[model samples]
Target: MPEVLDARALNRATLARQLLLDRADLPVLDAVTHLCGLQAQEPQEPFVGLWSRLRAFDPAALSDLLTGRRVVRTHLMRRTVHLVTSDDLLAWRTRHDAMLRQRVLGVYRTELDGVDLGELAAAGRAVMADGEPRSMPELARAVAGRWPEPGVRALGEMLVAALIPMVQLPPRGVWRVKAGVRNVPVSSWLGREPDPPAPDGDPVGETLVRRYLAAYGPAATADLRAWSGLAGLPAAVAAIRDELVSFRDERGRELLDLPGAPRPDPDTPAPVRFLPAFDNAILGYHDRGRIIDDEHRGLSVAGERVVLVDGRVSATWTVRDGVVATTPLRKFTRAEEAAVAGEERKLTAFLSGGDDQPTA
Candidate 1:
């Protein structure tokens, strides 16, 4: 029988792998790659996500990466905009192409009825071939003549999200700067096309499994599917089965993990962590009991920023009028409150550009 990991053990291990146990000293780009990518639909949230996980994280460094094109905001895992290193984007985009298309179609199936998706994709690409970044509506209008039946919203969502691999260009995600999304084709923005799909094997899928376990390991196949929003990875898991080790969760479900990945001691102390909306650490598992209570799980998907206390979801936080307000889900010990206050002060300072106001 494999070792049985209870929820606390799983939580400690997850915190360790996620860099919450101790802030990592890695460069920004390397940290982003290690975690696969940060859920970045909110644009500035990745800065907070990294600040919590990294020591002395400079928001400007991440902004520079976006402007430099070393990192890109594109739709990848779960059909959401994520901040990913350019190399990962090039390597992983093709594998996710079918899933991206399917997700877009799922939302616009009725609006897009009678539309030839292939021809539409070609037309969309032609419009983007000029190498200029355009808003989704602009791109849609450029192609609407060919398919006037589907309105701009339906056509724009499909074309910008599924048909053309696009990067939400810089100035949009720059720290403290508010800008609307303007997209350019990934190929033009990154200076190279996405790597072609494998001819004989599932290399990209295998890579994703290994990467997922490295960051969120002891995870079930269902968790992998949930995090990635991709189906058909069973074969990928099978191909690499020999290279992985297994354990059983308290519920008797098998969990897969990389051989040398970190699984910290169950009793390890966990500091309070403020996570950005849609952070993958919380959304990465089908069974999130380890990191968040079942009753509070919906908060994760609802784009609520949560505070982790003693390694579990304990509070939700928000900024109102430059004040960081934290509403506790449960009673906090004096020590826990002190710790939360200390971290909250730092976070407020970061968010307000060095204004260390007390958290309400």
Candidate 2:
């Protein structure tokens, strides 16, 4: 029989596993791979995400990782931009290619109708082969002869957003620095092409299951599907069930996790964690009620950054005029307010590059 873990048990376990209960000591590259990846469509979001989870995280470390080619930002899982390790990005990009293309078509089917995607990809690659950094608009205009009807915005959005394996180049991802996006081929950016699909078939799905369990486990296959946006991973989980331990949430949902992963005591005290917009620690699971209440669950999808007080989202926050401003979703006790203030102070310093200004 699966052990039934109540919401508190699950919450504490999730906090421990996600490195929110305590800041982690892992390197940025290793941390990126461990967390699967950080949602980074907004460019600067991953820095805040890292700052929240890592002890003494330097924004420059991630920036250097991007420039050093150790980590890369690309559209991968669910066709959203993520800051993923270079090795993981290369290995995983091909597997996601089909899904990425399908999602793009789903959105722009009418506009792309009668347009040959193969020819478009070929032309896009030929244009990128020159190694000059081109914005999406420039690339679209370069190939305007083939499908000029979509206009530059639509054409560029489709190509960079879906069709090609491209990386938004630096200065784009530099810490605290704002720059316009310019595109470069992933192969050119990383200096090695993404791994070819396995002749034995994609074991990446299986690997992803293991990794997810290690980092976000005691989770269900539904949770896995939610985290990955991949519909075909039950077979992957099934293939590795013998290597995993099974349990049940209080809801009687079956959960799978690595046997030795930290399932902290339900009473383990959790610290305040200021999560970045769309951080996967909350967005990673299908049943987020374990970490966030349903009443405020809309905040997760709406991209409102959250404040994890005692492992639950007790407040929402925003930064303006160099102040980390917060409003409680629930009333806070004096202790909770102190904790939130301390974390906000840290966040303000991070946002301001160690300026001594206090959080508003």
Candidate 3:
């Protein structure tokens, strides 16, 4: 019989892997890589995500990484913009190509019915070859004459998001800077194309499996698919099955993890941490019952910032008029309330660049 890991055990293990149980003394690049990239659609939210997981994390350093092209914001992993290492964007883009196309088609199939995708891709590349970044709308308009049948929105989404591997340029994802997205091919930005897909046994897929497990382990295959938005990893999982350790959740679902990955005790302490909207710790699972209650599960997809007390989502947080405030989902003990307030103070200080502020 597989050992059963109940909700609390699963929650602690997740927190440990996510670097929330203890803030890691790791560089920003290393932390970003380890987490397999932060979901960065909101742009500013990743700064808060990194802040909660890393000790002494300099928000400027992440901005530097973005501007320096060591890290990029691109569509990957669920067809969403993520702040991933340049190398990861290069290595993983091809693997995600099929999924990306399918997702776009899922949204715009009727609109693109007669469009020749290959021809469209070539047109996109040609327009982007000018060595300048263009927004999705701008690029779409440039090529709309060629395929006037499809609307610019459909054309641009397919071109920028699926047909061509592209990155959102700097000052857009830069810390505290608000800018509209301007995109160029991933090759134009990185100076190389995506790594060729492995002709053999899905080497990139295998690597994704390991990386996902290392960061989000003791997770079911369904959870893996949910996080990645890829439905083609069964072969990769089979290839790696012998190298993994398995346990069952209380719900009788099998969970797999890297053999040496951390699985902390359920009774282990979890600090009060405020998570940014769309954080992976909540969205990365098929079953989030480990860290968030079923009734409040809608909050994750709704993009609410949440406060975790004892490793569970216990409250929603927001800033209003330069003050941090939280609304509780459940009752808090006095100690828990104190801890949340203290953490919020630290967060406020971090957000405001250590400026002293009046208590909320």
What digit string (tens of lDDT, one per residue) describes model 2 on residues 301-358? 8999999988999899999899999999999999999989997887888798784422
Q: Against the true structure, what is every candidate's RMSD?
A: 2.1, 2.4, 2.2
TM-score per prediction, in order, is 0.97, 0.95, 0.98
Error of 1 at 130 (Å): 1.4
Clashes of each: 0, 0, 0
Candidate 1, run of 10 with poorest lDDT: 351-360
In terms of lDDT, model 2 sits at: 0.86
- Rank candidates by lDDT, best first: 3, 1, 2
Tens digits of per-residue lDDT for model 1, 113-192: 99998999999999888888899999999999988988999999998888888899889899999999999998898888
TM-score of 3: 0.98
For all candidates in order, the CA lDDT equals 0.91, 0.86, 0.92
**Alpha-carbon lDDT of model 3:** 0.92
| Per-residue lDDT value at 321 in model 1 | 88
Error of 3 at 95 (Å): 0.2
Steric clash pairs (candidate 3): none
